[model samples]
Target: MSKNSIQIFDTTLRDGEQVPGCKLNTEQKLRIAKQLDLLGVDVIEAGFPMSSPGDFKSVEAISKLVKNATVCALTRANKKDIEVAAKALKHAKKPRIHTGIGTSDSHIIHKFNTTREKVIERAIEAVSYAKTFVDDVEFYAEDAGRTDNDFLAKVCEAVIEAGATVLNIPDTTGYCLPNEYGAKIKYLVDHVKGIENVIISCHCHNDLGMATANAIAGIQNGARQIECTINGIGERAGNTALEEVVMILKQHSNMNLDTNVNTKLLNYTSQLVQQSMGMYVQPNKAIVGENAFAHSSGIHQDGVIKNRETYEIINPEDVGVSKSSIILTARSGRAALAYRAKNVGYDLTKIELDVLYPEFLKYADTQKEVNDQDLHQLLSSKDNFKKSVNF
Candidate 1:
C-alpha cells in the first residue's frame, strides 16, 4: 500500500458491542465479519477473546468466516489473555493479537499502582509474547492520549523492538484536543527509535465529540491506521465512525489520503450493524443517518432542489441512498413544493401553484410534514387546482 493509503481497522464487533445491551451472538458476529471483509476494511478487531466464552466463540467463528481482512483479537498485557486469543484465532487466514497495558500516569499510579518502568516492561513482554503466536502483533498503550509524550514514545519504541507491527495510541477517555492528539503522534514519529518499521494507529473515543476530528488530525501527523466502528457506536459516546473517516479522506482529495473501503456499502453496513445490535442511529447523525440527505428547511430545500451539490457534499447514491428527500414542512418553499408535487405526478403551473400554496401551508402548519396523501388532499381542496391533481 502507498504511504498515503490509510488502513481501516473496524472494531464494530468488539468496542461497538461494548455499548450496553448491544451484544451480538456468534452467528451475528460471523455475518458482520463477512460484511466487513466485503466492505474492504483492512483489519477487523473481532473481539476480546478472553473476556467471555461467547466472545471467544464469536471471534473464532469470525476468524473462520472472514476471507480477506486481518482478523484481530484484543487481549490484556498478560500471557493468559494472549494465549486465549491465539487459540481463538487458530483458523484465521490472517490473525493479529492486540495486547497492551496502561501507560498514563493516572493509570500507572492509581489504576495499576505500578511504576512507569514496570509498565514498560509489561508492554514489551506482552508484545514479544504475542509475536510468538502471530507475526502481526498490535500493541496498544492504554490511555496513551494522556500519557506523557516522552514516556509514550519510549513505550512505543520498546514494543516495536519486541516485534509489535502496529502501535495503537488510543484516547481511552476521549480527553485530548485534535491538536494535542496530533502532536502526541508526531512526538512518537520523531522521537521513537525504529518507528519507521511499525504502523501508527489512532483509536479515539467520542466523549468530547472529537473522535473523528482527532483521528483526522492523527492522520495528518503521520498515523496510517484508523480504528473505528460503524455509526460510531462504542463505549460511552463511541469511537471514530468508519463511514465518517472514510468519507473525509475521500472528500478531501488534497489530503492525499485514501482507504480501501467500499464507500457505496457504508449505508448498508451501518443499517446492518444497527439492526443486528438493535441500536437506533440518531436521525441527524452524519453519513448514515436518516436525515443526512433529507431537506426540510425552505432555503436549504430550494438550494438542494436547484442542484444537490448546492447543499450536499456527498451524493446520496454514493452512500447507497437512492435519492435525496424534499420533505414538505411549514418551512418548505414554493420550489420544494413544486418539486415534491412533480414527484407524486402533479406538474403544477405558476397559477395553479399560487392558488394551492396557501392551502398547502395551512395543512403543513398543522402537521410535522405534508406527505403525498396530504398534498393530494390540499390540492383537491382548491377548486381551481383540483383539476390538475394527478390522483
Candidate 2:
C-alpha cells in the first residue's frame, strides 16, 4: 500500500467554494474539513487565505481541527500572499504553503501581463519564501498544460531545488487531451532532478470533460498525487472528482494505486458537499450519481439479470450507493420484471415471470417507474386466479 500509494489532495474547500452560488461559510468548511480527514484525504486545500479575512479564519479553524491530513493554504507567486497563506496554516498539525505562478504564455501575456522569465523567477521566490514557514511546500505551474514542456521541466526542477516537496502540473483550462497530458508528466518524471524524491501531482480542470481521464493519464506516467475536488465541484467546469479517481483505481484498471479513502464513504461525502455548497449534482454524473448504476432499458436489464458483471463494472455498495433499480419503464423486459418482483419478496419462476412481463409493460407504458406494491399486486392477483382454478 505504501509503495502504490496515490496521495489524494482534496481542494473542495477552496476550488469547490468558487463555483457560482455555491459559497460555503467558515463553519461549513470546518465540517467538510473534518469529514475529508475522516474520509482519509492526504491533504486538504483549506482556502486561499489572502482572498479575504473570512477565508483566512476558515483556513485557520480547519487547520486547528485537522488531526491527520496536512492542512494547506493556497497562495500566488508573491511574498505577501505566501506569507498570508503561511500564517493561516501555522496551526496545522502538518502545514503546507502552496505557492505558484502562471507558466503559460496566455496567462503571462494576458493575465499577469509579464514575461515568462519573470514568472519563473516569481515561482522560485514564492516556493522559497513559503518553505521558510512550512517545511512542506507545493509549487504549481498554473496552466502547465499549455506551457512549453522544456520550460515546464525547468520550472519544476527549480522549485524542487528551492525546497518544494511537490510539483503540481495543472491542466488549468482543461485544454490537453489525455495522451498529451501523460506525455507532459512523463517528460517531467524523466527529466526533472530529484523528481522521484518529489511527488509529481496532477491538477486537471474539466472544461473539455477530460479531467478524470487526464488525471489518470498522469498516474500512468508517474504522477503519485491527484489534486481534485469532491463531486468534481470547482471553478468553471470543475476539477477531477476524488471519488471517481479513487474508485477507478480500486475497481477498474490495474493501476494498483492506493488512497486512504474508504470506498463506502464516497456517496455520503458527495452528498454532503452538494448540500452544503447548494450545488446539485447532475443525475448522470459518475461514481456518486443518482443513476450511475440504474438500468431502465430492455436489453440492458436482460443482460444485467443474466449477470450483473454484464452491465455493472463496479458494485453499488462499494461506493456507498445502494443497488440501483431496473426502473420499470416502457423499455423494461422479462428479466427486469423478474428482478424487480423478486426484490419485493416474490420468487417468480421463469415461467411465471414470462407471463408477468406483458402486464409490467402495461404499467410501464403509463408510469414513469413501477412501484413495489403494484408489482406485488399484479403477481398476487395472478396467484389467486391460479389457486381458484385448482379449487
Best by TM-score: 1
For model 1, which pairs clash? Answer: none
Q: Against the correct fold, how does model 1 do in TM-score?
A: 0.99
TM-score of each: 0.99, 0.94
User: Model 2, range 1-391, lDDT digits (tens) per residue?
Assistant: 2658999999999988898998889999999999999999999999999999999999999999999999989998888998898888888999998889989988899999989788878888888888889899999999999999998998898889999999999999999999999999999988888898888899999999999999999998999999999999998999999988998899855777778888798899999998898897998998888889999998999888788888899988888887765878888887787778777777777766667777777877888888887776777777643653232
Q: Model 2 misses residue 25 by how many Å?
A: 1.2
Cα error, residue 372 of model 2, in Å, equals 2.1
Worst 10 residues of 2 by lDDT: 382-391
TM-score of 2: 0.94
